[model samples]
Target: MAMEASMVKAVIFDKDGTLFDFTATWGPWTADLLRDLADDAAHADRLARAVGFDLSTCRFDPASPVIAGTPGDSARALEAALPGMTLDAIVRILIERSRDVVPAPAVPLAPLLSELTDRGLALAVVTNDAEGPALEQLDGHAHHFAFIAGCDSGHGAKPDPDPLLAAARALGHAAEDCIMVGDSLHDIRAAHAAGMRALGVLTGPATELPGAEAVLPDIGHLPRWLDATT
Candidate 1:
């Protein structure tokens, strides 16, 4: 059974798609990366297919492994496209280049995060992104989170409860007292697996996902949902 939103004391957020507008932040970067690495238009298509990116639209496919998969997973998917490079080489390049991409926040982060913090909710970030790049992307706003963990940060990635459980403990809250807010099913799975409530946002490609407890248009609508659900 779901508890009232007012009872929640901490929030665990997914970085991409949830906090940052997924396509707006990643689409152009992926397109540029695909072009930079590919041999030609045909090669670009192949590369795009490998990562589940659509070059013509510059948007990621909903089923794209890159959307929720780790950077290492993305590198392995790309192995067949690049002949001479090893997976480790590709992963290094991806991580190095990733550090250069600035995130486009879904809403003005300062106010939204301030609102949450002001409500006495401890905040944390859990992302499938590598810890280094994930921290870099948060930039000035990293201060908002009490904890931030990525796939490389010791605990296992999402769809596994380890990181979520750790984040809740780090925030000094039980899983049941926290909410996992994100834009992917991976977030939902991890949240549920960790015994937390899951809230979804539509900042990514999907209009609606099946497993979310509630689906909002974006994180901006969270206060309203909290109000109504309370």
Candidate 2:
């Protein structure tokens, strides 16, 4: 199970679901953000209809290419409720609240990240979160990444190749040389679109997504798979 630095130039991680528990990391913040969105004149009524103060299952739709996890559903619901608000404004609010939501070390990140870095494999995070919270999680880690790319930092979010491509470039590596580990189809789709290999981790439950190079139980098994041919 030892990992070799030569096998992986860099490891690109999907933040919310893969590196950290999506529900544990984002659930409370999402609830608060949705409540705030509900208070807004533009979104209050619509958000009430979507989830009615319950934030657990209130995600953007699973069908949309623009959306990713259940967290995105709340975001999308807010956007739907508020017709004319700029995407920038909505993303800004979500990102700010996410700063208070911290990832649990129980998710098993420190050692793997340190091991990867120790082996000289560059580490980067490519997430759908806007710039603010993305940086917040990275900042909370005493170990730093070579690059961190957020949705607001580029042309588009997950399922789009831009953010993934940007992360690879920031690491000074080719997309083909990076291993993208995530918990959603959007992560798989984005990595594939960028010509990279992806590993899907079922930190939540089983999903019907296809296209990733492999799927693992969680981040704990990821490092060993960097050289996996399957």
Candidate 3:
């Protein structure tokens, strides 16, 4: 059953596919990174396969670890194709390159976030991306979030309840008083493990994520859902 919006004191969002359009934001970057790392067409293909990316379409597979995995996970996949690169070096490269990729917001973030804030709901971001890049994507809208956590924030990544629980603690809300909004099974699973209500968005490839209280097209629809439920 869907939790009542009146009962929700805070909302924790996932960065990549939840707040931003995943393919529009990351597809070009992935294509460029793969090309930069590979020595030739064959090597590029190998790297794409390793990371579950489709070179022809430059889009990630729905099941790709890169969809919800950490930068370290992406580095590991790249390492399989670029054996000469150290893991730390690969991670650094990915992070540095990510800093330059312009993010495509799933909606007009500032207005939507402001509307939620006006409703007296605290907001936060919990992402598999590093804190720096996550903040970079948030940019002008960073103030909307009361808390922002990344995989490297030391609370551990999704599928573990630490980050979600930490967000609730920071927001001064109980787990049950917060709603976790994301676009992957990892996010829903983590929210469930943390005892928060899970809401899924289709800004990513996911269509039917398990354990979600409700699924909507994107964050743009969240305000209406909240109003209707209340």
Alpha-carbon runs more than 4 Å astray in model 1? 1-6
The positional error of residue 58 in candidate 1, measured at the CA in angstroms, is 0.6
lDDT of 2 by residue, 59-145 (tens): 433343223632354466567676767656765666566778867542556677788788788888887777666776767563558
Instruction: Kindly list the per-residue Cα lDDT of model 3 for residues 1-230, writing each as its tens digit.
Output: 34434388899999999999999999999998899889999999999999989888978899888999999998987887788989999999998899999899999898999999999999999999999888988999999999999999989999798999999999999999999999999999899888899999999867778778889999999999887764
lDDT of 1 by residue, 77-161 (tens): 9999998899999999999899888799999999999999998889999999999999989989999999999999999999898
Error of 3 at 227 (Å): 1.4
List lDDT for all candidates, in order. 0.91, 0.67, 0.91
Q: Estimate each model's TM-score.
A: 0.96, 0.77, 0.96
RMSD of candidates 1 onward, in order = 1.5, 5.0, 1.5
Q: Count clashing residue pairs per candidate.
A: 0, 4, 0
Cα lDDT of model 1 overall?
0.91
Deviation from native of the Cα of residue 59 in model 3, angstroms: 1.1
Candidate 2 C-alpha error for residue 191, in Å: 1.0
Point out where model 3 deviates above 4 Å.
1-6
Clashing pairs in 3: none
